[model samples]
Target: MYQVRVLVLCGAHPLYTNWTAPRSTFTSLLPRAKDRHWSLLLHQGLPLNNMAIFAKAPTTCVSFLLPGPVIIQTDEASSEVLYPNYQNCWSLREKTRGRKKAAILQPGISKDLEKVKAGVGINSSDEVDFFVLLDNVAAEQVHSLLSCPALKRFAQMIEQRAVDTALYMLQEEDREGIQMAVGPFLHLLEGNLLKAADPTTPSGKTRKLYLYATHDVTLMPILMALGIFDHKWPPFAADLTMELYQHQESKEWFVQLYYHGEEQVPRGCPDKLCPLDKFLNTMSLYAVSPEKYHMLCSQAQTMELGE
Candidate 1:
């Protein structure tokens, strides 16, 4: 059996689900393209050939969600419409077309949060906005935990139930919320993305920092796949990071993962950092494709029907 570095044995990944192509078919040596930023390692069916792809491939990947999006989802605003002037308020951080945003929200909305603490609600304890209040309370509790000496242990205990529940829901073959969201995200790391760890040729190179702003719907599955999530749901503002490092002498790659600035150990690596080649070999199976993830998801429904 092929061993995975971090993920539990759920099943084959989307790319490997129905792949029957003979390994020998792709044996030709194809020259690298000059213009593109990243090339698939398996391009032209050859082995790892390019430096750019090797650079951007992060050794780490995982998930964690925040209260803001969760509150938005659960606050009966399924449509995702925000307050009138707030529609275009948030910025994408990255600038394009030589233009920058007016301003971007910091890691957490400390200023806005202070406003809430001052009673933006109809009343300090209104039930109509009670759910949002619950969110604020939970956020404050986590903030308090940061300074407590036993913060790590307390945080773990708090998150165990969330981790268990996320894992349980994702394991259900028929359920798509967590499972479907998970596969593509992992593929973005292992299957397609290139690493910037290795020094590149003189001109064309990929950037070292790749930043994405997304909600918790995308975070939980990744956490489950990595088997490293343990927290009482993501708080007001959370960060899940997958950092890659390269050895100066050996040229070997390593993956270090972090959540909200706290380092996490993936199950695959005993010391909590996975070897790059080993990590990719294990995760390659789950790499992206059109329909395989949904197909894998059907394993649940099929079992229930006994067909």
Candidate 2:
């Protein structure tokens, strides 16, 4: 049986890069800011993306993506744990997804099936439905705003601005975040591809698929790290796929990359198809070896100012 490892990553968070709430833009999304009591929500982790600014102090909210690797036996019928659930849909709008998208679903905090996890303010049926619709709105915004140029720049700027660690905790978080996910994925990639190419290896004859089911939070950093992300947001179900092929003529292997169905030329890949040897060599720099991802997590968190 082939043991395949898959990575699942994403988290809900709010990021502020030198914001000034009550700025002119706040009137655009939050018209009632002047009259409504927003500090409560703000304190409760409501993400106000470029939402004009709020406080003089920097904000620290938990919006993260980690590469959680789970090994599944490819030959087994019981390997259904990695799939998505068909039930339990939540449509809340309290939490914002990211810059390009507005607030969306933060479903009932249920850990197991059979019962609904009690939420803070979900008292009535109307509130429950409102939360569901909030999720829908967040999804709609994602569908409409993901590919904008501003998003690409926004993504790029986050990385660029992150260099100055005085503003935010981005430098370590961004790098460590990627090291957690991409690094592992790369490990799986290189190891599996090598196995597939080696005739002496026991599992060399088997074909494998390395799947990653992630939230946009983690995808943004990874895309940026790959140097292919144009700073725009990626929609749901979007995938960054890579395939390996063997050449019968030279007995060599090669790699092809794709992002959201479009062929992508990664930093090392000059063409649509890159020789597997070259691809590995080019990609070797990114895979964080010698250091475990959890090590990064164990360190203390930092807070920096925004540019």
Candidate 3:
């Protein structure tokens, strides 16, 4: 029986850098934030931010990804016990998959900020700073601060504006934005899919599951590239899964996507599980080969140096 192959890609756990609070304030708030929420998610009483927490209980990252309460007993020391449910996983060292394109993408955000300033009721730089502070707080703890209906509405507006600005620069405003942000990931994903479809080829080693640990920067772009981004800030430990299925009789491969847990239909595909060819065609708009990626990065760097 040939079981369906699955690819699970997800962002990392909450990190110090994920917070937008000032450095001085962050020193205090980080601990409080952890004490309030993150403490419950800890594994075996281990401290928050412990890298070994994931190593010991891989499924403790978040609620949706948690298959069950993985109990790792120190007495039963085995690889299977430590890392359950998966056989093979690879970590791409170059975590900044599209760092070169980030510069090209950043300039458009100023335009996004300009577009939203009026809507946000910000007339001055100080007001802009206030708006940002409020937005960050709302994102982290909306219910805690925003108790009044009017205040909650304002907070929602601020949060929406922030989310929209990020999404606009990533996908909504221009096609190139999506292309630049997702090109590297698309290239890797397409190559992997193609290889997994073939069995005879030397490089085509079939693996039942593939997991990619990444950050929101990588997750948002891939989602936007696939035309399924929900336009909200991706939460910590958010996952996007791509499942490849082979028909029992015909043996043709098909692709289906899930974000967090909800099934998603790709941009132009008719249904949830789309034919691999059509899926590749939809992805072709953003895939950047290594050679093209290098050339673009070089050009960008040269232009920046010249300027």
Best prediction by TM-score: 3
Candidate 1 on 148-261: residue-level lDDT in tens? 333232344334433343344344232333334445456666632344544553335654444444455345545655666563455433556677787789987788878756
**Model 2 scores what on Cα lDDT?**
0.42
Error of 2 at 149 (Å): 22
**Native-to-model Cα distance after best TM-score fit, residue 48 in candidate 2, in Å:** 22
lDDT of 2 at 199: 79
lDDT against the true structure, per candidate, is: 0.40, 0.42, 0.51
How much RMSD separates candidate 3 from the native structure? 14.4
lDDT by residue (114-203, candidate 2, tens digit) is 022123222343333222322333433433323333323333333332222111222223454445435555655677777877778776
Stretches of model 3 off by over 4 angstroms after superposition: 1-135, 142-153, 171-173, 202-204, 300-307
Arrange candidates by lDDT, highest first: which order?
3, 2, 1
Question: Residues 68-137, candidate 3, lDDT per residue (tens digit)?
Answer: 3434443422111111101211111121224323422456544544445544455534334223534444
Per-model TM-score versus the true fold: 0.42, 0.44, 0.54
Candidate No. with top lDDT: 3
RMSD of each predicted structure? 20.6, 20.4, 14.4
